[model samples]
Target: MQAEIGLIGLGTMGSNLALNIAEKGHDIAVFNRTTAKTGAFFEAAGALRSKIIPCTTLEEFVGAIRPPRPIILMINAGEPVDDQIEALKPLLSHDDILIDGGNANFHDTIRRNLLLDGTGLNFIGMGVSGGEVGARHGPSIMVGGAQASYKRVEQVLLDISAKYEGQACCAWLGENGAGHFVKTIHNGIEYADMQMIAEIYGIMRDGLGMQAKEMAPVFAGWNEGRLNSYLIEITAAVLDTEDAETGKPIVDIILDRAGQKGTGRWSAIEAQQLGIPATGIEAAVAARSLSARKDEREAAEKAYGALGETLKRDAGPLEDLELALLAGKIAAYAQGFAVMSGASGDYKWDLPLPEIARIWRAGCIIRSQFLSTIAEAFEGAEKESNLLLVPAFVEMMSEAQAGLRRVVARAATAGLPVPALSSALSYFDMYRQGRGTANLIQGQRDYFGAHSFERIDRPGAFHGPWAMNAG
Candidate 1:
């Protein structure tokens, strides 16, 4: 009996995904650059060995699968993916499917799709989220490719996808790059969420003189309520873990330098290029960049002083921090979706915003009860670009904005860095204003760059000489 599908790359994600497929009763043929990894996988497979056909080379991997074959590339993004596809291109027949399940830049996906346009071999840029454990169990699958190609493998994809309430958290977002684009923006929002949480943690530690032990229960409590999420739950667990040697909180001993694999930066960059304000996401990216300059920070601390050492802790406002977090979260999601909405129109992807929200409600890292509200908000709407304008979210924002304002004020006064939270509040205020200070910017642009500005009173573009620079 031939395997129904094939996978190339037996890394953690790929191997687990193959196991999942095999467990679902679908025979899978898998290949890897290093045959040793494949050997190890087969050994671990044990009873499942009969289900997974191990292949040492691309030709063998292709030969093992059935016709109209769907092969997933869980390999690294960029040139490596191209290399694999090029090697597999000669072997794959017409109507065969090639799926890229990695954190690829959406632009690259579009380019690759364009490159494979006339080849007859289909290309799918798919996003798989939920980390290592999620792979072994099930992961949220976001697919973007030709609709016909997607139709061919829909059932198999659905079978392997994470299910919530008996429905798969997988769907075809659009053709060419939509899935990766959505995933990119998803990571951006994740960065904002994590940064805001860290800012709150900062408030607890330095601002309120609370230790990890004292603060862990607070996160655990939050997880039981509106903030219930995998990230928050794991954060509490991370804080709860103590080092084996000194018994100090593991997080305290860990370096503050956070690592990123570029998706968050891409999200911020795309938003900026689109002329959309994703300040919350942008702030998070900037914070990580700043954190990376550990030496400079140490020097600055030595030369000047630590903000925590200098600033006085006024009110802890633990409950207010929760409210502020919720507000920031709403704003972050609003911005992320706004970017997606803009891209959908610009690229004519016709992305289903509501469906995207639905899939994200579970199986992804950013999964939260809040996503349900987001889905509901999008579903009930007449289709708008921004989530904040949705009636449900509008009311929620109105009620919770005060908390955001108060928290930002407290953090500012305490000389604490709350860039993500501050940016969210600023974005909210900027979004609500009928008239903003942008007129001065327009005037300056026209004065310096000869870029004409449109007058609100009339409809024509106008330029400012400004009294010939008072010469």
Candidate 2:
């Protein structure tokens, strides 16, 4: 099949992705609400622009592309996706492909897939990451849908993706919603990672009284170490630059209000629904919410007055603390993955978690050295669902839990809000502890309702009033 792609919504990510495809020598038909944006891409790409057909109307966009046409939707998630699908439905035929390349709720993706099933239109939920720059270059792509449909466009996707061990950055992440689910959790992990960096920044600024410029080298140095990641590397660059207008640090002058498009929140909510504790991801969500409430927090702080002294800079080694934080973050990510894995089982997607982790190692915001370890754990597992109990990961968590606890304690003492990271660590501790307060509540329920509690010894067998009376 000759590669001809159609892209809707010519925003930052979309325009870049479209340009990347065009640069790679594929015919691309681009559309935007405002036709001017499409022209901007044409002018920027110049002579290579002939490869792209700019369309203003939905009908024109659909008509311009070839049959079995692959349309990449880069619009905002939620209603915009629905609106685009509805608008495009009339123009599409059987066996046509629609790819959502935005941060959308996985459940919605599953719902949309089911809706389009008999219509003969194939829906692909793709998790695209690497931000604007990565989109223009090559970003890690996670795709989930019909394998046959994936195979048809695999080469095109590969051509536009970042490389990994001679394998394409794109993978058939399973059926229906798996791609978006992995992406959702990816954003969740991203939330935790960013919050961890922020916490580190807080420690550096508040504890060490180091300026952003002074801390930039420390992060840059860490980037060369195991802590090296896209986020950390970029953060160092961000720290190095200053705003010309403010003369103050660029980062400091920027507003504390963090923006979200609800993917992280969706992941956390889905985890709760699936009975999975995604504490790290949830903490990240909470951290963003807290960031949005800067005024409220300031008021509360002012009312409380001076509470305590600054943290004493101990001459102790921070290697253990860093290790513990890394482990806790890893556990949090594992828990989030487990939630998605469980959803896959229930949704019948049969997603390969190892591949999901491996693909996330580059071009994605949450890309980190830690994902390699996760991929290893998933690879060694007898079953995909057995990721959390993998021996190496378990050992790593065990080694780091103590340090994580200490770090959380220190943060709390310093009156710093490390909600996301701390919550993730707490969730990890609770998951591994083998006993939680919830179990006590369950015991109470069994005692009151004759709900038939199983002894730890008996395991799966249920015991009720009949067994008690007989005994």
Candidate 3:
């Protein structure tokens, strides 16, 4: 019998995803450029080996799949993806679907769709999250393609996806690049979340003089409360781990520099292009870039002295820290959703905010109990409503904002850097302000560049007095 679906690339993620498909009782045709790796993958399948057809050539792989085939390319993003698609195009029949399961830039996805427009091939920009383990068992699958094309493979996707309360964490979000765009924004929020958490860790370490061993339980406790999520749970485990070689805390021994594969930056860029402010994400990206300047940082520290020694302050209650994190999280998520809303309008994708939240509640790295609340909030909210304006979150922010205020104030006084946290707090403050200080900015713009400013007292744009004095 012909295989139900086909997969190319036998790298770690690709191999695991193929096994996952096979484990779901659907026969899968798998091919890799390296034929030996394909044999190894089939051998490693063990009990599920019978369900996977290992093919050495693209022709064999395409032939093994049934008509109107759905072939997933789990290879590297960019040129490799384009090259692979080109190789498979002639082999695929009319309506044969090609899915790019990589962290591709959304613009590339759109361009690829246009490139394949008249080729009788269908394309899907699918964003699969949860890493290697999730790929092997279950992943949060975000698909962007034609509705009819998605309908053909929806069952297999749902079967292989993670579940929350028996509902699959998989959906066809929109046409073209919506899935990848959402995934990019997801990483951007992830960066903010992680940076805020790390800032808290810095406070505990520098401000409170608490060691990693002492901080693990604190994180463990938070996991049982509102901050509960996969990231928090893993943070505790990571804190508790000791370096087998040096016997020091693993995190301490690890380099402070973090690496980026471009998704976070892409999210921030897209948000800016869409005229939405993702301050927390921008701060996190900036933080990572700054962290990479180790030599400059070291030199600056030598010249200016360490920040922790500049001021001393009593640490606030741990409850304040927890609440502060929650508040910051709300701001980051609110900004992320706002960016998506803006993109939906600009791209005319009509992205479903509620379904996006629902799928993120499981399988994805950012999975949290908080996402369930977000999903519910979006259900009844207007399409353009900010998440902070949702009644439930309004109450939440009302309570949590005070804690955030205290934390930012304390961090500032102590000369501790909490860029993401501070940015989130500032974003919240700016968002809620009825009268902002931007009037001065408008005046400055008008004085220098003849830019007009709108007045609350008048309906039309008005020029500043400086315009009358211009030479």
Residue 310, model 1: Cα distance from true site in angstroms: 8.1
Worst 10 residues of 1 by lDDT: 307-316
Residue pairs that clash (backbone atoms under 3 angstroms), model 1: none
- Candidate 2 per-residue lDDT, tens place, 303-385, comes to 99744646666533255446645665676677778887788778788878888888877777877777778788777737545
lDDT by residue (1-471, candidate 3, tens digit) is: 799999999998999999999999999999999999999999988999889999998999999999989999999999999999989988889999999999999999999989998999999999999899889999999999888889999999999999999999999999999999999999999999999999989888888777899999999999998889988999999999999999999989888898998999999999899889999999999999999999999999899889754324344547788999999999999999999999999999999999999999888988987898898888873633798988888999999999999888988998899999999999998999999999999989989998989998869888988787986
Q: Which order, best to worst by lDDT? A: 3, 1, 2
Q: What TM-score would each prediction reach against the true structure? A: 0.96, 0.91, 0.97
The superposed Cα distance between candidate 3 and the true structure at residue 277, in angstroms, equals 0.7
* Poorest stretch of ten by lDDT in candidate 3: 308-317
What Cα-based lDDT does every candidate model obtain?
0.89, 0.80, 0.91
Candidate 3 Cα misplacement greater than 4 A, ranges:
310-315, 381-384
Measured by lDDT, the strongest candidate is 3
Error at 183, model 1, angstroms: 0.8
Model 2, position 154, has a per-residue lDDT of 82
Best by TM-score: 3
